[model samples]
Target: MNQTHLATLLAVLEEGSFDAAADVLGISPSAVSQRIKALESDIGRVLVRRSSPVVATESGEVLAQAARRMALLQAETDVALRRTIARVPLSIAINADSLATWFQPVFSEVAKWDNATLRLRIEDESRSMMLLRRGDCLGAITTEATAVQGCEVRHLGVLRYRAMASPALRDAYTDRTGTIDWAHMPTLRYGPNDKLQTNDLDGRLEGKPVNRRVSEIPSSEAFLEAARRGLGWALVAELQGRELVESGDLVLLDDIVSDVHLYWQYWRLESTMLHDLTAAVVTAAAEALD
Candidate 1:
């Protein structure tokens, strides 16, 4: 297969359309279509589904990952030769809580590498690894410690979460016995994908279901703000909501806390760049996480 054709396929997948990819590559849409056709013909398999926004077929994903690895390798070579690389892609997946908290320092570390162009796909820790499986990202911060095939896992650290509520919300849920009513209080979740808040709370409540009204607020900061404003109670990470919990803006519920063990998973590429990034994440985890 031609290297340029492989890149063209990857570009179409990334840019989501042949015309957009053509603009990026400084070629006409016809040229992009021709390259994709040539690549498919050489591979003897259909690679992309010709939708309004093109999507890679399973076979095409393999080529896309190969292209990404090739680009990463070429960037490393350029770095060693003291040559300027236009953009060395560093696509990664991260959890929303981490993005709202310990992940910022990692961003700073990434900027220290001038050759890298960052791409982030945010999701729940439980689902972030899907990006790696799809060849969409080279690495991810995830809750699963089991290594993906052809990948390695590094245990970063546990991120602790405290169940917090506003003063008024807490009083409404507290009963005459000085014990809190767990079932009636309104609960807030980061999104439909997030089960952590409910999962931990259910376990702590002794297999009892938290049969409460749930509001789905997707953004990390906004979710915390909703909890602070007494809209509902939520699991608050220390890095994002510690101040509110400390300043009496948010009340810790039942003195209970949850620890989420985070792991860094990446393709087992023998690249120094991957190793450096892994080290940077581990170091930042030590500084920020429990």
Candidate 2:
């Protein structure tokens, strides 16, 4: 009935769990469950299936779409009345590596805006654009050049990655000639959806399986940490892994590098707040990303 309830429903659908949604909305799981129950009672229809991983019902999908539109419109209205309304928080999506490395400075730079706040959703670069397409975020830092529907794209910069491993791991896998066969080495992956490392290996090794002995660690920091501990070799962003390399925690496996060209994509809506936020992000990216 109210925006709070609608927002709660949207968060549950986006996060796929009551607890996760509650965390995002800064409410307790009980409060989120209560909101869903009340919403169902008012609508006379179950909006979500109560299960291990919550799923939105058909009715819930419709309402979720409505809520997204309403939220966007509300943002627009706030921007139009910027002098009257307090500064608005901008919701954004970005990859974990970028967030860990270059993205935080953008938020610091933008802190100069009297009324702006940033709500960040950290996803993989391959999937971040999907967040923008689904209305979960106003803008995204993504690897894809193609713009999502209703959005425009701007080239932010390229993120370069180097094949890296701990010295011990490298010594175990590499021959005296410094020649290495990737298929023989164990690999550390960012997540199930991550193909950055695999794709890099593909380009270098001609479609060979990347050391089937793979360890899947989902978090950016965790993945690097795993690599540092010699769990497996990993492809790491140059910016993120540089200090480790200098400290001898990681060694470059080969000169082979992967460069992912990143783009900023956002809805083509006419909103001053969105515009200002986009400018700040782009400026920051230019300074941070090579």
Candidate 3:
């Protein structure tokens, strides 16, 4: 019915539960239930099936699409009425790994532009595209090659990471034949989804015993710091780890390297502010990341 009701229903469907939707919408579960009931009554259909986790019916999908369009239109209308032609906030969703490495330089470059504000949502690279589809963000730094609906993509550059350890640690573990048995050594890992170090180790071990003794360091900077402190070896981004490597704090683990290709994806709307921010990000990425 109203925008608020439509938004509440959409949130409930996306979040898959009334309680989760209420938490996101900053309202009570009872309020969310009432709004959804009102919406279902207005539509004259059971838009959502009530279960352990809510699911949108076919009718709910139609309403959800309409709700998304309405929200986008309202945003454009507000921008037009404010007479702020090129000053709209540029909302971006980016992965944490990039944010921890080269993305901050990109932000620094964009911040120099005075006309627009930057809003960032940090999630995993694999999940950033979902934020774009849900109208949660205007752009995303995604690993995805295929663009989301209503968005365009550009290849920014590749971020290269090197397997690294502390000099003392590397010397202690590596042998004369250059064959380091990781199974006997501790490892510093990013969260469970982090494949940079583990994948390489898996290949090197080749069905042999490899160290699964991992310390879960979620923050990128912390992950590198853990390696530097000789807590364990990790894959550190070239940009973030280069200075430490040069300072003799960290040592690259022989020739093992991982390169992650990154792309910038943004809505294809005709917004000059978004264009400026994109250009700035691309420029910075080119400089900071290969």
lDDT of each: 0.87, 0.82, 0.79
Q: Candidate 3: misplaced stretches above 4 Å?
A: 9-32, 42-73, 83-91, 106-119, 133-136, 209-211
Q: Assess candidate 1 and give its lDDT.
A: 0.87
**Tens-digit lDDT track of model 3 for 144-234:** 9999888889998998878889988888888899877677678887777766667777876786964487899888778888999999988
Poorest 10 consecutive residues by lDDT, candidate 2: 80-89
Clashes of each: 0, 0, 1
Model 2 per-residue lDDT tens digits across residues 1-290: 87888889988987889999999989899999999899888888998898867876778766775676677668567766674554465778888888888777777766876667788998888888767766667789998899887788999998899989999988887788887867778888887888887776677678764437889997889989999999999989999999999999999987877888999998787767678878877887898778
Clashing pairs in 2: none
For each candidate, what TM-score against the reference? 0.93, 0.79, 0.77
Model 1, runs deviating above 4 Å: 82-84, 201-211
Clashing pairs in 3: 183-211
Global CA lDDT computed for model 2: 0.82
Two-way lDDT contest, 1 vs 2, winner: 1
